[model samples]
Target chain A: MKKEWPLWEVFIRSQHGLAHKHVGSLHASDAEMAINHARDVYTRRNEGVSIWVVRSADVVASSPDEKAPLFEPANSKVYRHPTFFPMPEEIKHI
Target chain B: MSNDTVQYLLRLGDNALILSHRLSEWCGKGPALEEDMALANTALDLLGQARLWLSYAGELEDAGRDEDALAYRRNDRQFCNLLLVERPNGSYADTMVRQFFFDAWHHLALQGLCRSADERIAGIAAKAIKEVEYHLRRSSDLVVRLGDGTAQSQKMMQRAVDELWTYTGEMFESDGVDEQAVVAGIGFDPVALREPWLSYVREVLSEATLRIPPADAFMQKGGKQGRHTEALSYLLGEMQYLQRAYPGAQW
Candidate 1:
């Protein structure tokens, strides 16, 4: 019996007002241990204000191979470009 | 300014120094690779903290000495770390529980140190406390997991805690040295640090389904005065051997 627990993905916010970004994955018996392991592994520098650990199975990630089709189409949309519109000339400032 | 203050800080420094040295022994011997790295990293943090504290103590005494002099030159009768820390790393469970106990107390003590009257001490404490906080969390997390983990793990952790518990009381007891530091505002009231430490430990133990060992025993003492168990001499001999034998040899 392979009694080992599933792998978990770790994300951490380095400090306040920062988004939690994926750091790495670790194997643990449960969510608590996973977070603990993540802390020891990732936050040794005190580089986190918040952490989010999820079972690796639960995270939905976009495929890198699909990036051109998924994101490239938007690049040709001229209206989406902020340069299309001039900055409003405010009475007080540009 | 006071001789006793120098003594008190040296005690704190020695505890961190020796414990860090003991933890470093687990560098390649940990139960797992990740754990080995974690222990080794924590040991480095403690050694850094010890060097800073010892250097500051030396400065306060104006003894024309520095951190290395104190660390390498100190005799066996001069170290004041608890016997528990000096104990061999018997097992993963043993090391984790021992670290848990000390980290809990360290967190509280560092909190008090943050307000030290000495600017240097306060600055060091402020910086070091953050690292100790993480260490406390790491140790606490393992303690709970192991305590609630399996029958064998629980038994081992419980035994480690029981054996180490007697030494914990001395952490909160103030001696003449502590009294002087407290009066000078350069130290904390160890007794004042007790309640929060107990509550923190109690909370973790309770959640782990472990009972607090009865507090009725005759608490162990004398660690802060360089009077140690039989284990320390052996540990010191190994730890100080290179420096002692080579006398100022450097890499």
Candidate 2:
């Protein structure tokens, strides 16, 4: 049987001030190969200024069973929305 | 002088065109999806460079030909690309080895041309060097990985290096056209690219744990002079088919 390469999750920073956003996944033998694979697979259209890759196996995620216990309480917290805060018209970009 | 410059540009353009065709062969057939994309990207870059060069060649020739006419109408006997680029892409290892060798020379050649006395030549080289630099890096990285990889991979890479080494000599073989271009300050001497090419190849091979073939081994020549192996005829036949049948066909 042909052994398959490990899966890597890719992230891209589209510009200097932008945060790295999860893009996609690919298979590679190592981190360097992962980075190269990410560049080829995800950034072909001038979509990124920087790239980061992590082994998919290393990522942890909350299970669907934990969704209600972890997030249901926050749904009713209207104060978290900050809807009452007034915005200054002078602050354009914000 | 203009004729010599035109010929020099054809040499440059044909190298890119033929190699671009060779690499595009791997477009849907790469060992992996990522590799497929990478090879295709490199092929596109070379094709763009070819258009620039062949377009300039046609302009300098002052003939009715355009870039498409020059590219699709030329016979194999008229092509002046180095013999190395036309060699068959046998295996993945073979393709990578061929790519590594060509990319190294291309990077050096473009670097030299960046200082060309002709503004147009220098401009083309400047735009091309960035893509060629990335090509060199990727191919070099693969060479090391495959060469120092598993026993089977190491053996395959070694075989590829040995097989392709002889063809590399044609890249540095200077001739009358090159001489005229150099004298006219429109092109650099191919002979000057040899030392740096060898040093870089040697360093990379050593790191890859692959043996460097002896520098003085009997070398093949004549591709730049338009005497090519049978491989080029087959390549040109396929590459020119659409134009040959349709005659000025366009999308």
Candidate 3:
């Protein structure tokens, strides 16, 4: 059997005041190397300020193909959003 | 023609060019695919920096040559890079140690270059220093983590450091270009750069739980005048192949 590191999924915040979004995955010997690998791979363009790499197996992601039932149902609940309560035109704070 | 300025620029350009060649060798052979891409990217940055510096040097000399002409056409005897950069990438440990050493030196050099009187050189320095600063930080972080982390890593890091430490001296010692640039306020005396560099390196090494190689031994020298090691020839053959073959051909 070939010896190799487990895969890791990397997420990064491109800048301050931004959300951490999935970037890419890399293989590394351990957590530290995973983070280093992510920095080198995903952040070279100065595209990110923060990086988070987790073991690929540790991530629990919802299947993208099931999005209609998993997410569209929530979107159809009009009561879940506050758009119906819109009133004052002068209310600057949305 | 200011011989000192020409020499100074060649030193800077040669350092970047040779190191870029070395780094490019990691394109397919890095420990991981991510590292491979990262190294290749960094190599591009270095090669770009070299082109700018070499072109600038050519202009200052009023020479009809361009960057490619200087980079590919120059004989080994005309190159002036330090020996540390020309050594082969022996292992992951070896490459990292070589990078760590050069990054530290480059940070100091760039810091000085940013203040150069030549506006163009200063601008190039300003642009490149930011990237190089990050390179230094990342390399230093890896050194700390690996040196202090596992027995295998620690042993390899230590061995690499010990083997590479001998070449660290020539980096700070001035030849002729050093003096000229210093006088022109476009240069730094590498001797003056040594103390701060040592302190910075010591702090990082200490935090990494790595001991400084003893100062008792004599230092290796001769890269400034192009007395490169055996590895440089092979590296040059690969790097200069296309340019040397096509003499003046360009896209």
Best by lDDT: 2
- Tens-digit per-residue lDDT, B1-251, candidate 3: 28789889999999999999999988898876877887887788899999999999998887787888888988777788999999888888788888889999999999998999988989999999988987788789778877897798898989998999998999988877788898888877899888887888888888988888875567888889888777778788888888888877778
- lDDT at residue B61 of model 3 (Cα atoms): 81
| lDDT by residue for model 2 (B170-214), tens | 889999999998888878888999999999999999999999999
The pairs that clash in candidate 3 are: none
Arranged by DockQ with the best first, the candidates are 2, 3, 1
Question: How many angstroms is residue A73 displaced in model 3 relative to the true structure, after the best TM-score fit?
Answer: 5.5
Q: Is the docking of candidate 1 incorrect, acceptable, medium or high quality?
A: acceptable
Of models 1 and 2, which has the larger lDDT?
2
Clashing pairs in 2: none
lDDT of 1 by residue, B170-213 (tens): 88888888888888998899898888888889999988878788
lDDT of 1: 0.86
The DockQ-derived docking category for candidate 3 is: medium
Model 1, runs deviating above 4 Å: A1-3, A11-23, A43-52, A59-94
Error of 1 at B51 (Å): 1.1
Clashes per prediction?
A: 0, 0, 0
- Cα error, candidate 1, residue B187 (Å): 0.7
**Per-model DockQ:** 0.35, 0.76, 0.57
Question: Please, what is the TM-score per model?
Answer: 0.84, 0.97, 0.85
Model 1: per-residue Cα lDDT over A1-94, one tens digit each: 5766688899999988888998988877788778777877898888898889999998788999999999999988988766665665774542
Question: Among these predicted structures, which one has the highest DockQ?
Answer: 2
